[model samples]
Target: MKEIRVFNNVPVLEDWMIDKQVEKQIRFLKAVHPQLTDIHWNEGRVELRPLKRDPDMKDYLRSYGAWHFNEKDVAELKKFLQQINGKGVDLYYSAFAFDYSMVVYKKDGTKYEKGKVNGENALFTSVLAADFDGITVEEFRREKQRLLDLDIETIDIFTGHGWQSIILLNHRVTDKEILKKFTELMTAKGFKVDSAIVDAARVLRMPYSFNCKALDKKTKYYDPVSPKIFATTDHSWTERRYHVAEVFERLNSLPDVIKQSDALTDIDVKAISTAPLTNTEKKAVKEKAKREIEEVKQIKVETLKAVYSMLDFERLPEAVQKMLAGSQEGLRNKVMMFLIPFLRNTLGLSIQTIKQIMMLWGERCSSKLDTDFVQTEVDRIYGLGFKGKHGHYTEELRKAYGYLEFDKYTKRNKIIIPNGFFEDMSTMSDGAVRIFLAMKLGESLDGVKNFSKADIQKYAQVSERTMERNIKDLLSKGHVCKRRGNRRKGEGHVYYTNPYFNSVAGFTMLENATVKLMLSDLTDGEIKLYCFLSKIVGDSRAECWTSQKYLANKIGKKGHDSISKMTGSLHEKGFITKKTIEKDGVKHSVYNLNY
Candidate 1:
């Protein structure tokens, strides 16, 4: 079985625990959310963060034939088309488990052995269907009626009210891309579709749960088979669909979608959990797993001796001698301590300091393996010097120390070792979030006019896949506002951006970009009007009281002089405020928009 699980996911940066101070805001969010359970009265308003969500799993079931059929009603009816729609759900996590898989169908056409069900039959699922345009109740109601009047046997429509938009997935078709093309073809016939969900054109079955049953008409009994994963599946006996239109058309009762799968799963199974690893423990594990790789064959000892002929410090380069004299660390440090001992006697130095140097160099080991490499280096050090224990050092030491230690052992090397590093994500599948740390750093809206999902990903280092989840997170948590555009580009669709983070003063200058700049559909007239208004406010020394007619003439509208009405509309929008003032003994309304 192809394992597939649908989850309602969200991003981390947008998370916030609501507090008492945000009580009013919580009510506003609840007013818009249809699936909110209840406000945590004692916990304060922070519960709103997870409270705002986009529908995913709830929408999936709405589109499945096995869901919302109400077998109680099915027995009374011959066939039906069920219209299932879901309201937005509270999502603490963007990835909330929706279903499980219980069966596996091998490529070779044999049923998977139930003995290995835990290992071979089960698969963890991650669901991604049609985005916000999935399915709808109003549309399904119309569709079911249409199908019932026809010869259709079965049908399913799933719609999710996620982040205020509907996401629909229809399994009646075998291909999603093809469904999109077909929808477009229908659009040519006066309809536009968001998308289709057929990434894999096959039937899916829910696993573990015995809530579903396929009636075996020939056997005259309910033939129940429960799978582990949640999906649509073809019949075991034939390649045909059960045909749902006949039923929904035959029996016209629509029902509301069921709720959170996470809540049910949490009650029945272990949640997403993993053990963390300590830094030291992790480093040790890495070392133990390391395997040696050789780059070349070793040179014979006789061939090396013939090439060198003699070993003397005077024969080596000046750079080598300088490097050998000053270093301690790495392979070069071990060699230096080896050679310096021989030189100590010849140069008349104390034997005690030389021994101390050798012992000090040995302590530079980062791991037990490094110690072994150091030992080999120490032997090389002995060979490079004169034919005695008191040997000279090599140039390699200076180079190694040059990179490893710069400030003459005078300044203590400050190495910041993390107390621990996380490794639990390996099993969970996210590595420090789905994106990089640098990418997800919160942005200050001081210089931003408008931000896009791509912009969020580039700056926040979040995965593109997670951008949609992040948007709901940012908006629902009140990190941003879901602003509706009245300007030219797009009117009905909502735009989101940080409210508190975005500066109200000179906002256009700060981000150096705005909705007008990013989306091409924004009209030039709206942009011009904004720019003109901004210039007047920016240059004013004090409040200016000017007539609408004068302002209109200044704006170059000679046709009908719409100055008064235009200014009045701006005032009503809260963009500017009107106040009465006497100018040259004449009473006129002056607009104040500083707030």
Candidate 2:
């Protein structure tokens, strides 16, 4: 039977310089023995292997045929099998190993078992059967116990991800109705079991595969990672992808894999389990890895500097700044490789400006970067002399940067606000603009997006003048879009208290003249009053209407006089068409929202 971890690639990272420095090679002994290898690409249906089972004679397949045509996903099925058999495991994405999943065989492949494990081996509809949802806890307990029964005393699950690892509880308990039964059964053993749920794209080195045998009932090493795996933001997505086939391929060389142990009291087994790679050896490997880290750093710095300086930055987004700032040394070098050439190609940025931005990044991005890749990068950026695929390198650089941004923004922070802009947005006092953000923040009592004047003031938390200037500035720049109105013939107002507010498209301000009139003049109280009207009058979404009670309770201190003042001001400004209507034997004024 096999257990597979297919999230991270087994052997992805490669450094030409490091490879040269380490001088390590996969010494193939010329097909030492006849064997079968499997490949798995643990992705969606479009990624699964084989439309059906291969005939048993599939063994007749060979070298020339393999070279001529890739096996029709037969490799994938094999990978699935290898992983289930606990052949090998990888903790990170391996570029070289694309197909990886696991396959396993149970000796007694039957519907029921002697021990009540809530046993059920429901289905294997998938050509490889990687999705183990239908299998019950009873089934897993039987499989697991079967291994234990065969002198497999310890349960060291080569965990990859999902419900498979959640088995410390049970497979089906992931709460998805389909897989819950399995979750309950796997975790019920009350036995010491161990697994490692890979964190996204992280993976251990190839040499570490030998470490799997170290898993024990005491202090099992499940997280097979080095500090370097988390050293940069670049490997965010593929860090945890290790395919079954790749691991099996990597570990196939060794047999009875465990290292010889000396029964001693003073020595720890893990430290010397495998022949210690001599101190000089470890140093050489670390140094090579460290150099690769430096090279990546250099490129990253150049890219960020070139791109940021060329843009009329107003400034860098906040989230990006933090990512760039997280590391203290080698900042520019790190950013340059990851970002520079792509920036130049995409935006036509100047190298001189790149240097200047690199300087800025020195304070945040780590250190100054060497300009070695500049010319080559520039040539690539401009598609100089190459006509076949002009933007291949540029596109790759873009994809890399996008992956970096996903980690910086979605994984770690809310957004990418420019530095110092927070102070500016906070101090904004224009009643309308401030009210607009306040409404947007859902009237945050603790923050700026709140609409009420007091809450706005609390949110601004800066000098009154500063807040007022930004609010007015936003008004003048036409940041606020829709203007609430007092009355209109066709638009009879249903509810009345204050106007509502809406943000218009930032670039489309020149087209909408009505909003300009609404922001022309206003006191603090008047601004809040009008903002309230904007909420009710403008075409706000239906969900927004739910918060009116919260707003009223907060802003009720301001008398209805504020409403009257706003209505009069809106009418005078030609913002609405108002008319008198009779309702339930009473006269009422109906207002409408102007564009």
Candidate 3:
């Protein structure tokens, strides 16, 4: 039934060959949809020759077709598979199921109406898959070992060029967000994962099918001898479905390479700072100096720097920076287009300051700009008023910075915090503020079932006593309400942020203000300042005029100096733009929210 060839004294199979591939495909299908029955066609569909990409056309999936199968149609499925074997087109199957009755396809083998699988039409997914491509065998081995170390069991599919690690969940997951988070956590675990596949409608290479792309002689991936087929060397199929929490807990348990990069030295905390660690005891009197310095350093930069990488504006392209310093013969326009506006809008420099800087930049150029021309350019740019998409100079500077992959803020998913919440936050203690924010964020994400007091402390980055004390404070203040559960039932207090503060409804604060406040590296003091500013600024205004004395009083700070320092810190960190304006013989600071 199959042809064989001899080349260079080696016998090669002309067709894709694998052991028990048909049986394996059946088992995978059954595992994915456990309710498969002979009475009706199964939920999933088989895709034939799906378009990878097209230079001309968009919505390529709509141009493709699929084969629907019944439980008793294994022989027919086999016949179809045989017909397409080595036909130089990929065979794919939706990893998740769709509503069979609603499925539709055109007579010309193209998808019609509701035939394509997507988050809306697709029903549920039983497996979470991560695709890794173009990696070396040794690298793959290392990734496998990393998973082994984490005790994460996956059905590892060797798909021609790379591996696809699939985690078969114990139950079908309807929440796409949870599935999305799984891939994100995998990325944090140092796995080079293709995050695009974490969706309800994703497809994988059929187990019995050949990787037709690899057979193309024109492509760099073409291999003549290797059989580019879906096969697994280890039979590590998970026997039991893993609870979503259990899987998440395992993935989030260990610190990945980035987190562990700065291994804590054996240096005593007492040696770093004399101020006792809130929970731990003092080790030695001599450790006090070291402890204080370390604490100050940690508070100022070290820990927060690692978390909020967006502050590193230096990560902007070296070419862009070099252009600002000195443009070569052909690229003077780039400095005018990109660098000038970057300094004006992003850096928030005054026009005069920008002029002075540009003059210096011109001097450094190979062929220096004429003084009057430089002056005219600066005047024209300033006249345009730092607006993006300004008439002549486009927002190419902003675009250049965007390409740097700055630490992205999480999408709000329409969760809006009321402005009153920020005002209330200004009145609370730092520990209480963190705990309350954590609970609010937790509720927004998963709800009350998952976050306990211990979990709250971990998320809030506060101590046990801090959590207990502040949680009580929150309850007494009516900012948070808690319901206690029976200890005998292994239940704990479930706390909820006040609905007034945490509303998914139609209220709004500064855009992504809550998420940014929760996730940024802003200190408690800085957060207090930010909350106060955000409250004043509200949703409508971009900039607010307020005095430091007023801000200090609102934030419960005794001195305006603290407010000034916080404002300066916030401005330096790109959270806000602070400028002094003298209005009616009195000086006031204009704070513009940037997050």
Name the best candidate (by TM-score). Answer: 3
Cα RMSD (angstroms) for every candidate in the order listed: 34.3, 23.3, 30.2
Instruction: Report lDDT (Cα) of residue 130, candidate 1.
Output: 20
lDDT of each: 0.30, 0.29, 0.54
| Model 3: how far residue 348 lies from native, Å | 71
TM-scores for every predicted model: 0.15, 0.22, 0.35
* lDDT accuracy of residue 413 in candidate 3: 24
Clashes in candidate 1: how many? 60
Q: Higher-lDDT candidate among 2 and 3?
A: 3
Per-residue lDDT of candidate 1, residues 419-491 (tens digit): 1111111122121222211122223222334455565566444566765564553354343455555667655
* Pick by TM-score: 2 or 3, better one: 3
**lDDT (tens digit, per residue) of candidate 3 on 390-506:** 223324433322233312322232244565555555467766766656665555554454466787876677778878877776787787777886789999876666666444423
lDDT (10s digit) by residue, model 2, range 1-595: 2223232212333334233312211111001000112123222111111111111212322111111112553343334323322222222211111112223235566433221112121211100011222244345444433322221212122222211221110000111121222222222322222222111111112211212222222323234442111111110000011122222222233232233232212232112122223343355446534532332222354555444432323233332433343233312223444334433332222343334444444434322222322333333333333233112322333322332332211111111112222223323444434344433333222223314334344443435555555555454534333244346554322211122323231111110112222333445544444444544433321122223233333345334444555556665654444455677996655655332
Q: After superposition, how far is residue 375 of candidate 1 from its true place, in Å?
A: 74
Off by over 4 Å in 2: 1-284, 288-324, 327-546, 549-595
